[model samples]
Target: MTKDLLGRHRAVLPDWLALYYDEPLEITHGEGRHVWDADGNRYLDFFGGILTTMTAHALPEVTKAVSEQAGRIIHSSTLYLNRPMVELAERIAQLSGIPDARVFFTTSGTEANDTALLLATTYRRSNTILAMRNSYHGRSFSAVGITGNRGWSPTSLSPLQTLYVHGGVRTRGPYASLSDDEFIAACVEDLTDLLGHTRPPAALIAEPVQGVGGFTAPPDGLYAAFREVLHERGILWIADEVQTGWGRTGDHFWGWQAHGRSGPPDLLTFAKGIGNGMSIGGVVARAEIMNCLDANSISTFGGTQITMAAGLANLTYLLEHDLQGNARRVGGLLIERLRAVAAQVPAVREVRGRGLMIGIEVVRPGTDEADPQAASAVLEAAREGGLLIGKGGGHNTSALRIAPPLSLTVAEAEEGAAILERALRSIS
Candidate 1:
């Protein structure tokens, strides 16, 4: 049955839509932190479907809200006043920290980011954008244009004149050897030099933690320093929080808070975890920027009744249960455990990230060269050992990404870490 489904998927799906594992397993059902494949094999789900499932699988609150909303109405276009959408927007706007904020919903992170690009360009009257090196925003043409990861970006053609900036990846870069203060200074100086050479950009869009770029991040306050420069030039700072939002990073509610000294970003884009499993994406900005467009526009399916219900319920559950606190505690322990394991595996290059968004970079035993083969082997081994994880990096996809539901428990974290330890050993 799995083979037949795989055959059909390959026939119909785009080749670029990659799947994990050499022999891909079909996820049949899930509960809490575990999911079962079609063959009745249960695995601890650490990736949480690329961190889209912020809460546990089949979370009752989200499930009940989705069911109830579906019974009444599944979708109503943006033409009407949507109560759920309005309520969710109200909650998000209050939490967003932007003064006089306005929210615009979309169906995916790509759309949210594209909307952000549109707003920034229109408001500033500039087509130039500054994007961080090794960042991945989304897959749309507009989002792709700003993406700096060569592995994920397939085209050079772009509607925006994007200038790639320094300092997104701290471990592997020209300034990697510098002290934290020096690194920040160097990156800011580089940004200043880059700006001197080019026209003033509409905005500088960055991921607080570069997600597809292997969960890499600069030292805290790097953005705050850059914000000082961008602010002087009246350039907007747009935080792409698609993967790093909703307390996944543990310490902060929004990833941008890591650079809180600079105050809130001019614009922020978020998706993935906000709706648990439902599609909910949006941009939050000061009213002036969000209202820049003069013409009418609306997403056909954005903020549909069903998705808004899910977002409201999921956000409520996340806050009520303090999942962010849980992520901090459990994820801290999990990282320590993995760091211990990684210490014994020479192929493990680095263990980095905050909270649940941890990454284990794989490299040749004694060299800095990326070891994608070892990463793939470890992934296959982990699957065999009843654990499911993800792999990603800008350097040929050699980093093991471990972002579980924010509600992950200590026991489950320990179990997954043990399985991952054995998998890393197998690869070594």
Candidate 2:
């Protein structure tokens, strides 16, 4: 069934648009943590549309909200007064942690980051920027220029001058052998020294956890230490929390909180999970930074009534049910179970993540080299076992990304982990 569709897909879609499995499964519908393929095969979902399905599939509250809003009205440009937009913005602003916070809605993370870059460069008066190696911001012309992942970056051309930094990946960088404290110190020194040689950068934009870079992250306090250095130089800090926000990491509300001893980042961009499958993304910054632009800016469908209705309902359900605590409790058990399973498999090099987000790095047996082929095999094996998952890594896409919806139960976690165990052992 999917083969016929696959032929049509290839005939029109761009080749760069990747798909999973030997033959991609067509997900017709889903409810809770399970989804069905075109052949009516049900499978436990772990990837959650690359972690975008923050709540659950076919969630009743979000469905009702969208239906109700759609029945009344949907599209209203930014020129009009939008109650849902204003309400969601107020809620996000209060939760942003930035003093005197302001919110600007965008349709995707790329646009949010682009708006942030615009704000930073205009306010700081420098086109230079600092980005982490193996990090991915987005696909826009401006966003791709700052991306350090070779596979994701298609062109060398960029409007801003971006310099890559170390410390986002903890296990493979030059500072891999250093202790957490030493690693932080070394990265700080590098940033300080780098600044001495180049023009002052507008900001340092980074993902607290590199989602597309295989869920790798440095020591908890690494960014906090860097924050101090950037603060001293009057440079802004932007946290790309698209994958790490809304308590998906299990331990914190936002990934930046782990390294927030120095306080919150100057500007924060978020997407993916907040709207649960609805297209909603935005940037939160201080009033000074957000209001810096004198020109008019608006996203046609960014803060539309229907999407904001979905966002309001989703966010309410998330908070009212204490989903963050559920993630912390459930994700803790999931990771430990996977770790035990990983120890029994030779192809499993490392299993690391916080909260509900997890990554299993597969490698050539007895070697540290990334094994993309083995990773692909496991992905296929998992699907064959009635399970669905994802793969990502800046290095040849060799890591299996396992991020279930935040609302996952203990039984579901165990079931997914067992399926993954068989998948991992198959490659052994």
Candidate 3:
């Protein structure tokens, strides 16, 4: 953990890696809810490696599994059957509660979404997809095509068909005045309008709780209604649980459960938290939908031995310790604290989200909308105070995203909140 080591590492990062507005930090090591920079400065991990690292960074169980599996076999092509991969897929299907579920593993969340889109659209042989505004599927061609935000555009290729609808979440301004009834009505109306006079879509992609686009939670019953609409249209519903799954939401093991249904989505994509820090992603498909997929469509790096082992270890840790329950309790506490903070702080507009996927929207004078600069300042101040957070919303910025690892403790949550309060105080 020295400047020399960072210099060597930085040299390896190619210029082709787009500078996404900000520079990357030189982090060296991490354990549980804390990380160390190259200069050996400890920082609280409120961002959880940009919403990954489900069991906390450097968890012994995940590391041991990866190490042991790597020693045995790092990878084998999809041409061969690997025990760890098969077991992991079985576990995902069982936990997902999807009947006759099938899985397609990949290396990242984007890939999982991409696979979901391919399987879903191909199954129905329908090109049209209905997506919500402020939705983020991923950066890949298919994913970006359905993404609602314009900032991520510069589309490499156009989707065969796509339509955008405004869901329960709003990206334009604050929600202090919106009522529950109004929220549901807005979503329903938009969905109706999108479906009206349009060809029945192949699939409807949505996040049970929007993450990267903004920490916007959908209204109650919205999912139920949305699902009904898709069902009527003969379209599949794909839940992008990449940021919301693996017990991060607390109420259930997966994000789609928040919608309160015996059966959730026709297809569900998962990544980020499954393998702790390892590169792994997957999709759980309904039996009927999966049955339509061709057998030859397999991924090369999907479900590699190391990734599968890590996923298994991570899942074991989460279930054995009931980390989802911790997320519900701790995340509820954090949201309440944030609401209190928002009341006192003028720049703080609204606090929203479920479990650990939380956001603190910064308000400006005479404006209920997002203030990206203020959010950035708060992120910097928090980092200076030994906490790390992320910034995201419609305009490539706005609210501070406070998704931490499930291992984050109550004491750490309190300390991080205090630091965030101080950061807001420093902003004005």
Candidate No. with top lDDT: 1
Worst 10 residues of 2 by lDDT: 389-398
| Tens digit of per-residue lDDT, candidate 3, span 1-428 | 35565467569986545422143467889998999987688999988877888878899999889889889989886889889999999999998878889887899999999988888888999888888777888878888888877766558466657887766365453442567667666677768886887887888888888887668876666787778767877889888999999888877777777675536789999999888889999889987787686766667899999999999999999999989999999999998988888788888777888888898888784577668888888888888898898877874447789999997789989999999989988987
* Cα lDDT tens digits for candidate 2, 265-316: 9999999999999999999999999999989877798999999999999999
* Candidate 1, 1-428: lDDT as tens digits: 99899999999999999999889999989999999999999999999999998998999999999999999999879998899999999999999999999999999999999999999999999999999988998999999988999988999899999999998988787998999999999999999999999989999999999999999999999999999999999999999999999999999999999998989999999999998888999999999999999999987899999999999999999999999999899999999999999999999989999989999999999988999899999999999999999988994547999999999999999999999999999977
lDDT by candidate, in order shown:
0.94, 0.93, 0.82
The TM-score between candidate 3 and the true structure equals 0.93
Give all candidate RMSDs, comma-separated.
0.8, 0.9, 2.5
TM-score of 1: 0.99
lDDT of 1 at 422: 94
Runs in model 1 deviating more than 4 A are 395-397
Instruction: Please say which candidate is ahead in lDDT: 2 or 3.
Output: 2
Candidate 1, number of clashes? 0
